[model samples]
Target: MLSNRQLLVLQVIIDEFIHTAQPIGSRAISKKDEVSFSSATIRNEMADLEEMGFIEKTHSSSGRVPSEKGYRFYVDHLLSPFRLSNTDVDIISDAFAKGMIEFEQVVQKSAKVLSDLTNYTSIILGPEVFDTKLKQLQIISLSNQTAVAILVTNTGHVEHRSFSVPANIQSSDLEKLVNILNDRLVGVPIVQLHEKLSDELTHLLHKYTSDFDAAYHYLKGALFDQQSVQLYVGGKTNILMQPEFKDVEKIRSLYSIIEQEEEMAELLRSNKDGMNIMIGHENKIDAMQDCSLITATYSLGDQQMGTIALLGPTRMEYSRVISLVNMLSKQLTNTFHSWY
Candidate 1:
C-alpha cells in the first residue's frame, strides 16, 4: 500500500502528465512550491511508484510518465464525480434544440463539437434498432407492385425503406394492412416483440392470402434491422495530430476500423441499456485495443432506448466525458417526451 503522501504525489504527477503529455521529473514537482514536498522525498516516492508499476522511467532524463496501470488506478481511485457549470449545460442543451434534427445529424454534430472542445478525435453512436420505438409507421404505395415503409421516431427523425408488393394488392388494402400493423405494434419496441410475431401473423392477416407473404417479409425486415444504429465519427483528421497516434501504421489500422460501419454498428447494437464504460482490453475488438468508449442509453422507458457513446484514446478524461454523456442522454429523454 502506498502511504498518504506517496498517493498524493502519484495524483499530482498524473495530473501534471495529463496536462503536459510529457514525462515529469522530481525537480519539476519540487519546483511546484504548491506540492510542499522536497525534491528528494518526491523522487523517492516516484521511484516506489515505478517499482509498483504505477509510473515508468522512459530514458536517462530523470523524468517519469504514468504507466497504463497508473492511469487505471488514478481513474478508479482518485477521480471524483465531475460537476458541470451552467455554461456547460447550456452548450449541450443548444445542441439538442436544433430544429428537426435527425438522429444522425445530432450524433455527427455532437462528435464534431466534442472534438472541437477537447481537441481529440470523437465518436458518437446513434440509437440501436433493437430498442427503436415504433412511433409513426406508414405504408404508402408507390405503384401497384411496390410500396414504401416510412418510419418516424418520437424524436422527429424519419427513416424509410422501399418494399415491393404484389400487384394484385390495392392501395386501400395496403392502407388497411398498415393500420393493422400500426394498431397492434405502435409504441411497442420492434425488437422485443419481433421474434414473437410468428404465431400472431397468419391469424391476424388471414384476410389477404395474396398479400400475407409480402407483408411478412416487409415486417420481418423492419424487425430485424437491429444494426440500424448509425454512427457518426468526427476528427479522424485530428487523431493524426495526436503524438501517440503519430505512427503511420497505427493511424492506418485505427482509421480502417473506425471507418467500418459494420463494426461500429455492432458496437452500438450490444449496448442494450443504461450507461456502459469499456476501458482498454475491456473491449472485444482487437483493433480497439488502445481506445475507450463512454456510453449511455437514452430511453423513453424501460422498453425503448438508443445508445450515445463517445470514442476516444484510452487516455481520455473519463470524468468529464462520463458527465457529458450522462447529461446529454438525460436531455434526450426529456426532449423526446413531448413527441411521445
Candidate 2:
C-alpha cells in the first residue's frame, strides 16, 4: 500500500509521462498547483515510490518514469473520472448522426473516427457470423461457364465469391440449388450452416439433380471454403506518429502482426464483455509488448457483436482513452439495438 503522498507523486509522474512521453522529475511534481510540497519533500516520496518498484530511471536520465507495474496501479487505483469535452461528444454524436443504416458502414465510420480522435490505430472486429442468420443466397450468372455466389446475413453483411461453373451443371441446376438452399437454410445461424447442409440439404440436392456431387462441391467451395473473420483496421499509419515506434524495424514488426487479421481478431475476441486494459507485457503478442491495448465490447440485443480497440504505447493517455472507448462502445450498442 502506498501512502497518500506517494500515490499523488506516482499519479503526477504517470500523467506527465503520458502527455510528454518523458521521464518526470520531483521538481516538476512540486510545481503543480495541486502539489503543496517542496521539491525536496517530493523527491523523498519519489525515492520511496521508486524503491517500491513504482518508478524507474532511464539510463540516460535522472528523471523517473512509471514502470509497467506503476501504470497498472495507476489505472486500477489512481485514475480520475474523465469527462468528455463538448467537442469530443460532438465528434462521436455526429458520426452516428450520418443516418447510416448498414452495420459495415457504421462500424467502418466508428473505426476511422476512433483512430482520428486518438491518433492511434483502431481495429474493429465485425460481429461473429456464428450468431447471424442467413437472410438470402443468390447465384448470379456471369457467363455460360462462370457464376458468382453471394451470401447475405441478417446484419446486412454480404460475402460473395466467383467460381467456374462445371460443364455438367446447367443453369437450371443452379436455379434449383439456390431455391432449395434459400428455402431450407434461410433463418439458420451461419455457424450451423455447414452441418445443416451436410445432414439435411445434401440428400435433397441429390434427389433434385443428377450432377449433385459436382454442384455441391462448387457451391461449398464458393461459400464455406474460407469463412474468415471480418476485420476493419483504421489509421494503420498512425503508429508512425508515435515516438516509441520510431524505429523502422519495430514498426515493421508491429505492422506485420497487425496485418495478420486472424491473429488480431483472435486477440480481440479473447476479451470478455465490458472494458479490458492490457498494459505492456500483459499483451501476449511479442510486437505488442511495448504497447497497451484497450478493448471494449459492443453488443446486439443481449449478445456481444464485436470489439472496439485502441493500440498505443504503454505511456498511453489511459483516462481519456478509457472514457472514449466506453462511450463509443455504448454508442455502437445503442445503434445496433435501434436496428432491432
Candidate 3:
C-alpha cells in the first residue's frame, strides 16, 4: 500500500506524462499547485516508487516515466469518476437523435461518434445473430434463373443473399419451399436454424413437396451458409497521430491485427460483463503490447448483445475515455431495449 504522499506523487507523474508524453522529474511534481512537498522529498518518493516497479528512469533523460505496472496500478486504484462535458453529452445525444431504424446504422454511427470524440480507433461488435430469433423471410424473383433471399431477425437486422434458380425448379416449387420454411422456422434462433431445418423440418418438407431435397439444398446454402459475427471499425488512421506509434513497422503490425476481423471480434467477445481495461503488455496480442484497450458491454435486458471498444496508446486520456465508454455502453443498451 502507498502512503498519501507517494500516491499523490504517482498521480501527478502519470497525469503529467499523459498530457505531455514526456518524462517527468521531481522538480515538475514539486511545482504543481497541489503538491506541497519540496523537490528533495519528492525525489526520495520517486526513488521509492521506482524501486517498487511503478516508475523508471529513461536512458536519455534524468526524468522518470510510468511502467506498465505503474499504469496498471493507476488504472486499478487511482481512477476517479470523470464528468462528461455538455458538448460531449450533446454529441452523443445528437447521434442517436437521427431516428435510425437498423442496428447497423446505430452501431456504425456509434463507432464514428466515439472515434471523433476521442481520436482513437473505435470498434463495435454488433448484435450476435445467433442470439436473435428469426422474424421474417422473403424470396423475391429477379429473373427466370436467379432470385434474392432475405432474412430478417428479431433485432431489426436484415441479411440478403442471391442464389441461382435452376430450370428443374418450378416457380410453384419455390413458393412451396418458402411457405414451408416460413411456417416451420419463424422465431428460431439463427445459430440453430441449420439443425432445426435438417432434424425437425425435413419430414414436414418431404410430406408437402415432391422434390424437397433440391429446394432445401438451395435455401440452406443461401441463408445458413454464412452467419459470422459483425464488426464495425472507425478512424483506423487516427492511431498515426500518436507519437508513440511513430515507428512505421509498429503501425503496420497493429493494422494487420485490426484487419483480421474474425480474430478481433473473438478478442472483444472474451471480455467479462461491464467495463474492462488492458494496458500495454497486459494485452495478450503481440502488436497490442504497446497499446491500451478499453472495452464495455452493451446489453438487452439481462443478455449482453455486444462490445464497444477504444484502442489507443498507454498514455491515453483515461478519465475522459472511461467516462465516454461507460456512457456509450449504457446508451446503446437503452437504445436497443427501446427498440424491442
Best by TM-score: 2
**Per-residue lDDT of 81-167 in model 2, one digit per residue for the tens?**
999999999999999999997788999999999999999999999887667888999999899999998888888788878889889
Candidate 1 local lDDT, 1-340, one digit each (tens): 8798888888878888777768899888877756887888998899899999998998756688887788778878888899977887878878877874466666666777666656666666655555666677788888877778777764555777887766666677677767777777777665655654676655676675457776666567644543454667767787776656777887788889878878876777687578777766777887667777777877654455666677667667777877887887787677666545
- Give the alpha carbon lDDT tens digit for every residue of 45-86 in model 3: 999999999999999899999999999999999989999999
Query: Model 3, poorest ten-residue lDDT window?
Result: 297-306
Error of 3 at 62 (Å): 1.7
Candidates 1 and 3 compared: the better one by TM-score is 3
Runs in model 3 lying further than 4 Å from the true structure: 142-145, 165-167
In candidate 2, which residue pairs clash? none
Ranking by lDDT: 3, 2, 1
